[model samples]
Target chain A: MERVPVLKIGDILLVSIQIDMEDQTALQLQEDLADRIVETGCHGVIIDISALDIVDSFVGRTLATIASISRVLDAETVVVGMRPAVAITLVELGLSLPGIRTALNVELGMALLARERDFEFKDIDDDEDDADEAVVAAS
Target chain B: MALSTDEVGRFAGLLESNGDALTTAWTDAVATLLRGRLSHAELHRQIAELQKGFQSALAGGAGDLEADAAGELRGLLSELSNTRARQGFSATETAVSIFALKEAMLTVLGQDGDINATTLRDYVSFSAFVDRAGLFTFDSYVRAREELISDQAEQLLELSTPVVKLWEGVVAVPLVGTLDSARAQVVMERLLQTLVDTGSPYAIIDITGVPAVDTQVAQHILKTVVAARLMGADCIISGIRPQIAQTIVALGIEFGDIATKASLADALRHVLRKADVNAGRRGAGRRES
Candidate 1:
């Protein structure tokens, strides 16, 4: 099984998915990401899927799972670099992936993560609406 | 109608012998019907080209217009109709030119001598052949007209949805006309793609030129905004007129947390202020306001 590398950038963990992930690969990545967040105590995780072309429901569910897993572990999850075609497909497929923040690219994804950190600093329990507003502003 | 090889040979000889006279008669007949819509020289040139195509086809022993020998003639006729269709000539005018040759042929055939029974039989077949040609001309004209219309529609689609950058990290799509499903899909795709390309985290969909907002139009716009959000870009819908606003409330269509403004400028200011606030420059912009 191919493995997706997870790199640590400062206070955040960046996972650039450059391969078409098999079911096993995605599950493994989720497990590995959870392990790394606990080990490094990172507060944010950015999943970059810009290299992906066809994002089926399986991938969509995996992304949602990753977001939730990271959230439960006290790390904010931002899914960035979603292609226009992929977004349209996901929308048509009715998989909006709620609660997962998105940015146009990895750079903006980092900025969004930074802002989310700022929000966390200001408020211990962040407001859901406020988080979405930060997404709009940071994006 | 089908022409026998022998009769086809005789007709080809007749066309070649009286080439100039046949073209003159055909052109004059068509010019009168068209009321001088076409230049005489262009009409003459087209007539001459068709004549040459016909003579060559018959010389090549074409028993009917559908024969392989008539390929050049079909090509010439298609070209004539294509040009005439684009030049705004009616289908009838275009087909009439082909039918006019029947009169020119009959006049030429009668000038030779007394009309024999076999010659009359041949004239009937030849007249039928001209009818077939006339139908072919009409078909080509209609085909060309349909192509022109479809091409124009495609060009209009391209012209209608242009995603342009309004400022740094901001883009806008000024929409006009009714929003159909196909157009909505296009606008959505282009806006999202532009957001990805320019990394413009903010977008403004200005509908100032849009005449009205129906439920379907509102649905399309909402879908676009949602799709943009998925791509990590925020879309602000701008240019809601008073009547459109009333209609939105009447329809109970909720924009739901998406920012909207009265004008393009307002939307721009909103985006700039949000951007400034996010970039940690909120104090200065808020103080100015």
Candidate 2:
């Protein structure tokens, strides 16, 4: 099966991967997605794994690796739409995806990204305003 | 050969009567074969040669009585050696298991190398002995040790304090002990669940019994407060010992939005006053209704 599917939504890129993910194809897909994320300069990356039935050790490790790589590329990666069974299985196996953000669905993840972007732009505007006031005061 | 019934009966009686004599003769013959009258080196060489001859004769086939006997002796010796090796391994494993169990018992009782009948019975019951052999397997010993440790930890945790309701919407938990990550997590869950169950709006965690606090424990406490706030509860921390405060300052941890009080009583008073204000507001609303 095609392990990863990359789709661009507005300025955000959505990367959807399949279940039972433990093969060379999965690794290659992750690498390809990471490269694409870096190249496109997308605002955010949504890792959709809604089709996964079980999240085993290998798949959990791979997802965590991808999340880390995405961070280095300056793109926030949010894992979205995990099934309850998959979550329970991961907990039972003592597998944790530390340093990775998770959301219940893609909509919430996208909304969260938008909010963060808004906050960043607001900080930039505030800084610009402060710089302008400082210049005026010096004059 | 062929024999009548009367002849067969007579032969059986004769064999029974001569059994002791036959056994003695057999023993003598074996002793003679095993006797060492020559020099030690010569005897060793003879035994080595005999072993080699027996090996070769067995490899050839058991075609004669002497060769068959030699092969049987070699087989019997090998079997005995294997049995002895297995017995030795079993004995060593048993000894190690017993030692581990003893250590586990001592740890549980908070003693060293003291064993009594009651303790032994408790250990056996906790270990679930299968039979009267008084043998507990290594796996069972390890499991029992873990259980004993967990039980002791749980007892220590329970002795710290139960969640006390100070006001209608506030509860307090006094935490003690060196909060390792595991114990910190347990405290977090217990406090959160109590808040949820009591529908309290505020929780005060007094860290009086905490001997030392590290970054991990601090982070755990922060996480718990954050989670509780997410569930619409305010967490107040009190009883910050000087050492813990020094450590926290040294580590440069940010408390930020969490409320801190000097003592549990102060924290409870703060929460109760807030609850009273809310209650007054509710009473005014009822009067207006």
Please report the candidate that would top TM-score against the real structure.
Answer: 1
> Candidate 1 lDDT, tens digit per residue, A29-78?
98999998898777889999999997898888888999998999999999
Worst 10 residues of 2 chain A by lDDT: A130-139
Per-candidate interface DockQ score: 0.47, 0.03
Candidate 1 regions with alpha-carbon error over 4 angstroms: A123-139, B110-117, B246-252, B281-289
Which digits, one per residue and each the tens of the lDDT, describe model 2 over residues B1-289? Answer: 2223343243334324443443334333323443433345543443334333333443344323234434553443333233323433333333332223233333444443567775554444333311211232333334444665688788877776477887776888888778887777667777766765666668998887778778888887777776555344678999987777889899999898788887888888888886665454434334343
Clashing pairs in 2: none
Question: Each prediction's TM-score against the native?
Answer: 0.87, 0.37
lDDT of each: 0.88, 0.59
Most accurate candidate by lDDT:
1
